[model samples]
Target: MRYDIPIWKKSNLTLDEAAAYTGVGVCKLREMSNDEDCEFVLWIGSKRLLKRKKLDEYIEDMYSI
Candidate 1:
């Protein structure tokens, strides 16, 4: 069966989904994910995903992007 999970409920998010959820923009999200100090980036081969909970925490802790 296929799951119909929402972006907010997901464990990880694509750049587009994250952009929509966080209002951070896809290019910016990609840039942020490329940072070595970033804690929420997950790589599956050439694809990058963001851990949603960690992203939320990161954003919450940050004063600015």
Candidate 2:
């Protein structure tokens, strides 16, 4: 079976917003970022930002059923 993944185009999101969108606890998301497991996270001027495109890609790559 094949599945089509939706493409997201938003450039960035706050950590809290990403957590809410992904339904993952903020603490866990932070841990993932710290461990370098957050493929969607980027550092912008010392602030961490999440790319909506990357987050959607991560979900497609890791959670798509």
Candidate 3:
């Protein structure tokens, strides 16, 4: 018998979550969030929340070489 698993959807993510997704530590993520060169990251109030699509795009852009 096969079991069906439910898919989870994430709209917004905390700094920690974004860090894990990018394989970077929270401290580094914070630094990237502040860096003007990193356009993929966005700040929501005091918290840094990364859009899922944007993060993916950033990763692809980084690995294009």
| Best of the candidates, TM-score | 1
lDDT of 2 by residue, 2-65 (tens): 7544324347777777776778777876776775666778997789888887777777787432
TM-score of each: 0.92, 0.64, 0.62
Q: Candidate 1: TM-score? A: 0.92
lDDT against the true structure, per candidate, is 0.94, 0.71, 0.65
**Candidate 1 or 2, higher lDDT?**
1
Give lDDT tens digits, candidate 1, residues 11-65.
9999999999999999989989998888999999998999999999999999999
Q: In candidate 3, what are the lDDT values of residues 1-65, reduced to their tens digit?
A: 97543212565567777666667678876766677666666676776776666666766777431
Estimate the Cα RMSD of every predicted model relative to the unseen true structure: 1.0, 9.4, 6.5
Segments of candidate 3 deviating more than 4 angstroms: 1-8, 36-38, 63-65
Q: Show the lowest summed lDDT stretch of 10 residues, model 2.
A: 3-12
The TM-score measured for candidate 2 stands at 0.64
Q: List the residue pairs that clash in candidate 1.
A: none
Best-first order by TM-score = 1, 2, 3
